[model samples]
Target: MALNARLEIRQGQGLVVTPQLQQAIKLLQLSNVELEAFVEAELERNPLLQRDDPEPAETAEAPEAPAASSDELEFSDTSTAKADEAMDAEGDDRFADDPCAGGPPLTDWSRAGSGKATDLDDDAYDRALRRELTLSEHLTLQASQAGFTAAEAGIAQVLIDGLDEGGYLRLDFDETAERLGCSPELIETVLLKCQGFEPCGVFARSVGECLAIQLKDRNRLDPAMQALIDNLELLARRDLSALKRVCGVDDEDLRDMIAELKALTPRPGAAFGGEPAQTVIPDVHVRADPLGGWRVELNSDTLPRLLVDRRYHAQVQAGSRSDADKVFVADCLSQAAWLVKSLDQRAKTILKVASEIVRQQDAFLAFGVEFLRPLNLKTVADAIGMHESTVSRVTSNKYISTPRGVFELKFFFTAAIASADGGAAHSAEAVRHRIKQMVEGEGRDGDVLSDDRIVELLKEAGIDIARRTVAKYREALRIPSSVERKRMLKAG
Candidate 1:
């Protein structure tokens, strides 16, 4: 075969994801909180992008006598005159250059504070004032204070990053040494130092071990307690007698020791002195009335109204020097416009999806959990004319605030079980709730209903559930067996 390079022409159609297209798609899928972050990022990157400043106080003037009609008012005071001026000002340069002229701004309604504009310098100042010490930052501070060699500091950094989110040193000593190009002894030495750093018990290997290190720091690790921790599985399984025998303690002493053990925080790494609580700002607020039914409202107060400044955009287009700068500005402006459009579409889609969910699950709103019907991704997808995956993406990690309580979007969708009255399928969650109610209302003196009895009760109510299925549901709900319940009642 002759070796040669040749070009051949062929026609094919395919989709390619350019940066602008990708941004639009991403913006569409973003929940209100995520959209806020994206807009913040764009504001940092593009000088033309800004949170819509409150309409410049409209220059208060004395009001004239009311016009006979809007048509009789001064042309300058009307919106039509302003539109004509905008059209004449841009001329050919309007749509050819600026895409943000007629679009709404990107906004988010999932943040908890009043949406206000702060300058770039203010952002910097805020960051400087409230800097957080990440796991790496804390380690670096410790290493600097300890006065380690440059090589040792580098090795320490690698180990610090290797620590898991829970701040445990999960890497084996040898593996860490190989990656750091140091001996295992050096790695262990650095790990020991890391364990003593701020927050007290970081760089530990396991939860039990983490607690042990903190306890050792405070001189509180008793031999029996340490033994119990080493065999945590036995303790967790309620093998109380076995634990007592192993620790050689009396029942009262064992109980007291167990209580003390419970007080210890196994994940000591989480004790980062003063982290603020995460406040959840709901995207949608829904209320149900006694007779009037449900009403859905978007929390507009949390939304960030962002827009491309038309005034500044014209200045950039008219005063450009380099081709690169022009292209950059155009690209950024396009992105800003697309972001605005995507945001509008996103809001509409979220509202539509929420409305459909409320309509389908109105029974849950009126009555309680027992009235909840079985709903799934396919049903929602079919109703909304969207793919099941799209529905899944919309529901995942997003929450809906409703009359009952704050619930994840997926909470509305449950597997179906045969109903008690044999009318239709009921939600598994609803069935589980009914099982819980029956268990809760059981006679105290008489034998508490076993799984079989519960199944019979469900059958009488018109729900056709098997005994094993009832047992599984009961177990899932954390309800104890009949024997355990009887013992619990006696103890009560």
Candidate 2:
């Protein structure tokens, strides 16, 4: 081996994912809500970036640049303009006039009282002023109402704090009493007092105790009812005969008792507290065109419009003297430009992928699930001249609203199932739907369709699938075996 180092010039081409490219890829995968959050963060960090406000056509004007000296650099707004023009050329008018064109109409309650204030308006105003009371607040108010000595009130508060969301006390009475330097009898007494609060079952230790409290309040806590409450597992299994024997009641009386039990709230505290429900916002909208084709558009309401302020950037850069300040301004300008370009590219890519999906699955939209052809990411990616991974990322967490309903972009891509007659393959989703329909249409008195029988039926319909595959698809659809189905039917 030679000791001296030798220099050689090697020239080749390779793909490199720069920081901006990485950001574009990330933005492509994020849902609309997540992209809004990311853009808001960028707007805060980059001084040259600002949100593009919705302006009327008459009020819109071109942004002007500040006057600069001959020595100062003048930045042009051509890049931003070109990006906007590209987006407009792609499909700006796709959702211009109608915000809710493809989807259902949304009610604007803010403008509901513009005409006149009626009784419903007063009720709405009152509801807007009211706040939902949490479980802890309700319990604290009840504890305050129940008169107790200072020490007893402290113990009662501790017991209330120990209750779980289901209104069951999760703490051991003896351990709590030991920690508080009090006797277990005192703890038990405080617990009993707290159990007398509203909602009927505030401080019970078990499900049986919870039901017992409600039953006692209703004046129905007989020995038979108590026994029935104690054996909840038997009730869940629908073991009617065992419940009847345990409760020592005839069929008619047992039915009445079971109905009463069913009417009682099992989770008494659930109504008071939980996380609020979140609404799903679709990312794309698909509608029928006048020429009998499909029209696809991005949900612009969910997408944030952003622009780079080149005038402000030029002003800042011209005044900076230090190298560090100049570098910071340059970095901000670069980031803002990249972000705007990335957003435009992301929107175009999503629209392209969604349009192709509508084209390929038009049969499904016009007909039904049975006509959904076999599809994959590769097919869509090839049609759109992109990589399969890119298509996958674009489909992740993205939804499209159609005449059929709102569905995820990935919902149309299913594995292929071979056809019995060596024709075109069938979609796995279609096969699963067929299996589900067959199971649902079975009569209670008729013999349940076993996995083998399902395979036979599918083969007769020109679908070549194995018995195990049929069983797998059935299980995925949450359909039980023939024996379990029969047992459930007999029990019913």
Candidate 3:
């Protein structure tokens, strides 16, 4: 019974994630941008690793790049079978060719990730082709030509510096006056001059001020219109009667004023250059197959074409300069080979997971959002013969372009809401979409759907969701409560 030590032999299976295994695991979860950075770092660290980019002549000879699309998996079944067969062999066996290598499939597609739809907007193409002058640059140039007295010009520079990205002068005149060692009256005078520079509403201190400036430019800043701008909050609340009373205008005139107000820019500086919007490089592209089903493939432009330089390895090996040098060379060879294999494996795993998701959500792709089936990571994991955790990693930060639009892989794996009739469960996303449709299509006569009422509608549609669940979904959608909505829809 007492603790005792004895020589014994025992064996048990355990997961020991080696450095190589860790690399594969890390590669699975990284988004395209992160993966590229990781590959670039590895290239720098390992001399034997090289980028197998396409030659310029080969690229030029290639046909014009197709629109953002899904290939029918040029990585053939036979090639995959061959890869699987050789995977267990030594890493040295497959250094000759990169299994993931191909044409720059995304060529023009990566730079323009908004997809082919952007092509329809010639303005978008034009904007992309030209480097724009920023709000700061445009204002500074105008100030130089704006022709002000020395003191007024100095005050204008201070005012311009205080302007926000919306081109609104957010500076407190008194605080700015103190900072610039000038009188607040002089600051106001300079600001008035700066306001007339360009874009019409440049030096506005408030939304009402911004709009009033624009109206002044168009010779429409009548007293009633000015009153309407001042009471924009009432207009936003849809209190048409209140707006008409406050502005001293009839219903017809108020409606016209509101329409004119809508046409003015709320954010005048947003049109000018700011920090560029980041474009998502999708990991997978799903497109309609000519014959029938959905075609899914990896966005190969995102996949780094990597190869192990066996020639370099052989050259390094033949020298046999020292034991340390031999070890370093051998280690580099191992690392380079493992990286190539890991990348190939990562690509295959992504395609497998994506294809299974497309299969499960086939109804959604063919029809619309309402047809999206209840899905979870476990469902995809089991179908693809992988673990739930593995599927989660594959979906992390990964995006897919479908016929509908570019959606994150995680978007397809919505929680399930039980069915009222005990039929197939409904996807939470689909239910949320349904709730949104109901709210948006509500009659202008002022009938707003309450949470309880929404619950009833969902149940009628075969969703067994509770009133609390309905409220939660509504809140998540940012739809106001029935009381709030009724007030919003109040006419008088």
Candidate 4:
């Protein structure tokens, strides 16, 4: 039989991702710093959006709203508009009533004494507070002040350029001399002069040379000290007897020399010219409430308070003469409204997910990592009446600060490992922590615990992990094997 195509009516439902929905999804996964940058860009593009200032006085004095159920917390157009209106009014006041407002006028250093002295003082202070000079810049400054001849200065500059971050000269003097059209002896002389610069070890060709230079600067470069410095491998192995024979020193003198060597810097130039460390800012904070329960709240410092200026939108809409301009204004109003609603929804979702995580991991929080229970995304998602994907999005790149410390939200979730006695499963993280504790408590004088021994110990403790699994966890904790640890102990 031949089939004929015909139009038929059918009823179906599907989800569609609009541009605004995509933006809201993106906001859910962004870190605190990234969210701030995104909101700043949106504020620049949409003139109707503005940032709300943080006011502690008003927040403290205002009556708290009644607690709402989770169902009532879902995103709604009416509630979102009311919230935006309240935020807009709160931000419009340039000078709100303050108990500490009736004070004397503060001093304005910008207007002090014709401003010339103030400018000079400010410049000098700023320069002092700025970053210190880099390694290359320090060397160059010292070379300029050393009173070198023109040709000798050129040679010194070449040697400085050839130096590595450890302040070691990695190039051969003969090769440098050939490249610069000079003799090796002249190059060596210039190198010696450059080595006299600050930091005590700028142009050393090896580790021994670096330490020797520092010892010479301190007038402690005796024959015994030089011999001790030459055999660093024996020192690393902690062979005090070999060092005594090589340096011809007794136990007391060897101990003193070892202490002196330990005080020296290995990489002199490492203290300069690297990116500054970044500080982690948490999105949520957990603290104990006076009512005898944990209080989980979004960090106001990290949370962005944004509002749509409805008054501005109304004025622009009233002034529009053409249909296209009116449509443009209406589109802007719609976009601004959607953005505010999305932000509010995002905050509520994050708070809900984080609160549930804190509730499930309460044992871990109250005790320690050893007490952390097994948890997964579905467990949290089902408890909160949301999809697993939504829970994943909420945890990604977000951080929470608790009494313990700041940790990523994803740190609370761990894979489950079956128990030996058919009881509740154990958390992988807890098992790893237990393994680490056991290894740390092992006796140094006795035999080290092998992977097989560890597996047996874990089984005795009601954990059913394999020997290979024990080894994997040990490696993850950066602990060496039994043989390696035994070797290290013997050497020490």
The lDDT of each candidate is 0.61, 0.68, 0.69, 0.68
- Residues 1-492 of candidate 2: C-alpha lDDT, one tens digit per residue: 769888999997443223343345567777786777677767777787777766523322222321221112222211122323443555542111111122222222233322121111133224423757667668877765454433455566567656777777888877766555568887787788888888897688888898899999999999999999999999999998999999999999889998999888877887785333335588888778777777777787877777777778778999999886776677666556656655765666677778788999898678644456678998997786655666788898798887755667876775788999998898776677688778888764467899999999999999999999988877765688999998977787
Give the backbone clash total of model 4.
Answer: 0
Task: Arrange candidates, best lDDT first.
Answer: 3, 2, 4, 1
Off by over 4 Å in 1: 1-6, 21-31, 56-276, 288-291, 418-423, 432-492
Clash count of each predicted structure: 8, 0, 0, 0
What local lDDT does model 1 show for residue 156?
62
Model 2: per-residue Cα lDDT at residue 320? 95
Give the residue spans of candidate 2 off by over 4 A: 1-14, 54-276, 368-371, 432-461, 466-492
As for candidate 3, its clashing pairs are none
Regions of model 4 farther than 4 Å from truth: 1-14, 53-276, 432-460, 466-471, 474-492
lDDT of 3 by residue, 295-362 (tens): 88778788877777777678879997977677667666655666666677677778877888999989
Candidate 1 lDDT tens digits, 6-59: 999999744222333334434444556556765787678777666655552232
Looking at model 2, residue 150 earns an lDDT score of 36
**Which model is ahead, 1 or 2, in terms of lDDT?**
2
Question: Over all chains combined, what TM-score does candidate 3 have?
Answer: 0.51
TM-scores for all candidates: the values are 0.49, 0.51, 0.51, 0.50
lDDT of 4 by residue, 89-142 (tens): 666311111111122222332233322211112233344348587686689778
